[model samples]
Target: MRNVLVPLSCAALFSLGPTVASAAPEDGRPVADPSSSVAASGAAARLAPLTLSVAIERAMSAHPRLRAAVLDVEASDGAVQQAALPPNPSLAFEQEDTRRDTRTVTVLLSQPLEVGGQRAARTALARQGREVARADLDALRAEVRADVVQAFFSALIAQERVSAATESLRIAGSGADMTARRVAAGKLSPIDETRARVALATARVELRQAEAERVAARHALALATGQEEAAFVTLDGGADSLPGLPDEADLARRLSDAPTLRRSRLEVDRAQAAYELERARRFPDVTVSLGAKRSQELGRSQAVIGVSMPLPVFDRNQGAQREALKRRQAAEAMAEAQAYRLRAEVLSAAVELRARVDEIDALRRDVLPGAREAHAAAMRGFELGKFGFLDVLDAQRTWLQARMQWLDALMKAHRANAELERRLGAPTQQP
Candidate 1:
């Protein structure tokens, strides 16, 4: 019968087939594609065409470090709840036999009663630790968002640079063709054609370099978005009007909401709680037990009650209390340091933002228009044979350089705005 049952069980296991694979222990085999799960679950779909804001949000959701911090907060909350609950009671049973051949059995229950507000102290410490964990998570999210925004802007700037380089290359190629025709007709010297060719080659080299930069920027954006494919990344937004700047008083008020400062404050609270918990440990906890007992020789039964408490003999947690106190002091010092640093960062970023805004305005009002006028004048003079080819080339170069500079300035202003928003803990413009 046993042999038949064993065979039937074996047959049943064999029948399970691939369904049993799920219950099998992992064999330490690497997955064929690490991104297969992300591919199938539409994670890639969500990111396949990502905007800047979407990319930041995706990073905040998917970055493993940020997710771990969030999970730590949840776990700390659970720990706090556990710390608040009273200790569970213990149960015991006993039996004794004497020389007279009599037997006895007994059952007992015991519970350790915490004294000196130990449970309360522990709960407070755990709750404060949980608050610190929550603050840490918030700080991590803020930092990650800032990084993603910067990377997205960098990618956009690189793409714009590539476009500018391509345009420059096209213009240079056109100039080279005209110079070649002039040389063939004996209207321009062969040396002029050679100069034009050299300029075209330089332009082509710049284009290639710009293309490489764009590729790198795309990869950076993909990494920031937690996406493996650059084709999925996109930037559909442009810089909007500058945001209104807050006054010093208003900025000071806003600094209280900064994630880093808030995290530091929470750390101070946690340290204080730890100090108090250690101080409370100077008092001892009492353990009480009750039981029933029987003796074999006398054939008698008895009830027993016992109490035990630790004596504060050599060590009294003095060292631990001192250490915790020092830690609390250190946390307070750290909070002050963080506050000062935040103030300096905010002030510096604000100053830089205002400067960028001024620069952008100046470029719009003066530099760009002046360059355009000069370029137009040079082009007309060259057509009338009044200006030399070098003069025309110089004017064209100056105009292109000025335009590129303006673009760079605009990118700087955008980045400054982002930094200010990060410092002030506020929403940025669409850009």
Candidate 2:
């Protein structure tokens, strides 16, 4: 297995949190880490909170899909080694008759030798296949890291919502208390008290819902990090302050380095190698025999040297050669399609991420502040008998709605950034 080169940016984006240490493969192959194998289980029982980097490391180590990919690369290595080996020699014994006095015996050893670059072509094909497997492993590592980042953000967003809901609940409780005292003192109607109580109840319900969502989000995060059971660990960091997006030109330059496109290109090379192997096979191989022959009647032993080759008149590997040629053409076409698809996806993700950034900025700079002011003014006006209870409820609703929308925009922005990094096959530093 090739070494897993986890991008430094995966940790840099969350520099506020702890970092995971990456280990190189031993002798160009993965060695099972007993500690990492149990990392997820240990993390589940941890007294401290979990960090994004630690989650990613645990997933990389214990995730079944990632482990399978490592095994695939190892398997490809074995295949390459096998393909480079020469054919084994065969031994034969012959007897003309069962009677010992008149029996004639012969013994020979034959080795079928590959010719016309057959062995070289075969070895090249296997090496190309190994490269393809390595590319796959690289792509999967990126995927796993991206998934952990996204899941961590999702849980963090949910935690923020829970806080928001709790704050709203406290405000609603205060309003209910104020309305009750006013109703008892005859400054406000009993209906006002009822409305305030209802509002408080609604806030409590929203808080409950938010708490449930937070629990679900935590479980999802645990699953993303390859835990079999929900860890329910506190997330160490927030996604409120993320790095800025990369420039369009920078993203364009990264498109060629994406693992998906790289893998597709390698598939083309592997297919070409396969075609070469097939073409090489069209020429027949030679088998050379050398040994000693003994005749019972003459009581004499003679050396024998003979050579044989298959007649290629009937079978010239035409079908296999044609199939391999078509496959190579197909691989080339697929590589083109993959490149086009990656470009489109990167463009879309960048556009969405920019839009999300704009939206979040608007909500934070304009909408949320305005809504909070309006809600506060409405509460003050009601207390002074200048506005009705209904106005206060409307203002509070608007403020909460704005906050939720802002959080949602933040979540989308982070997710769009994650998607962009995933497509690029690495994390990029934001300027």
Candidate 3:
């Protein structure tokens, strides 16, 4: 993925005019030639086109949320390291005086050792926690990518709508011109011209609406890409042709990689590890220390060792272990529920996608052309004085309505395509 940024290097090189060598100074300081440099630097500040993929990559690299998530991973890694380390050593010093003159001093060092695999258990728990955090970061990245994809598609759809509206306006204008010519030739009533003008006005309104939608879509794309408005550009690719629905077996395989499902599974693993850690705590950890001591009366040094262990007389971690177990059970249930929901969503989206594609095909092939032919016939009849202005107006209205329906069908097909891609965890194409 290329980072979305203007090529300042190119701009600088292109913006600089012919560079002139500076004349040497006689007084030990050279005069600066800043004309070319200033021009180059100014040009480097101009906006450049950025594509959707590039924008997404740049945002992923620079986004504050992703950076924060990365920091959390590092913090969790540090926690794991701390858990793996042994307890700090202990040190002691003693001094004694005997027989009014003799004195002895001793210094001792001791290290406390963890017992009952406490270090290993704690490290395991920390490792699991780190995994959970990493999974969370992955989920966030996927969400960001999905948003960028959707925004890019929406912008493309808006552009297409604008194009369609522009064409409709042209058609309406042509209709108005034809009506005027017929009225001047005394072949049609003035009421027909009025109707045609009304249609043209409606077309202009639709064009304005389409333009507004395109502007809004561009803004959304800018937000998703973390780019300035001037840097926004059209996506490079068109909508991908709808693919055949996946078989049940294939869909099952693909579902494993779904971010939601994967996150839920990781949560289950984390909960299970937490439960085990709690259980391990039921066996108390022992701390042992060894040291050396000196006696002033005997003028001798002796080694001393001590061991301490927390007795599970009162709190055996039973309550904590039970709570952890319950949480683990809940996590498992949640994972199962997510899996079910994902399956349903994938299936539903697939069904809807197929229906939308079929409808678009039917509208394009059967309905729109028929309406256009009927409108042409009605226009010819009115010009020949075989029909009234009302008949021609009605036919034009029907044709316009059909064209709008066709545009709507296209939009639905695109929307369904987006939904299917989202459900399948597929990467979106350029448009």
lDDT preference between candidates 1 and 2, better one? 2
lDDT: worst 10-residue window of model 3: 17-26
What's model 2's lDDT at 280? Answer: 98
Model 3: residues >4 Å from true position, as ranges? 1-71, 92-110, 181-187, 239-244, 294-301, 379-389, 428-431
Write down the RMSD of candidate 3 (Cα, Å).
10.2
Q: Give the residue spans of candidate 2 off by over 4 A.
A: 1-45, 228-232, 429-431
Cα lDDT tens digits for candidate 3, 1-431: 13434576566656663343224555758677799788666455323444556767866787677789999999999999998898888787777765544776667676666656667878988998898888878777766666666676677767777887897789788889988998898777898899889989998999999999999988987777665666645556453343355567766777788777877888898898888888887887666667776666676888777778778899999999999999999999999999899889878866776787787778778988998899899878866778776787788778877877765665665565556555555553442
Could you give the candidate ranking by lDDT, starting with the highest?
Answer: 2, 1, 3
Give the per-residue lDDT of model 2 (tens digit) for 44-153: 56746777777887898998889999999999999999999999999999888898978888899999999989999999999999999999999988887777788888
* Backbone collisions counted per model: 1, 0, 0
lDDT score of residue 21 within candidate 3: 25
Model 1 lDDT per residue over 29-124, tens place: 654665787687676665555677678777877888887898899999899999999989899987766444777777888889988888999999
The best candidate by TM-score is 2
Model 2: lowest-lDDT 10 consecutive positions? 16-25
TM-score of each: 0.83, 0.87, 0.78
lDDT of 2 at 330: 100
lDDT of each model, Cα atoms only? 0.79, 0.87, 0.75
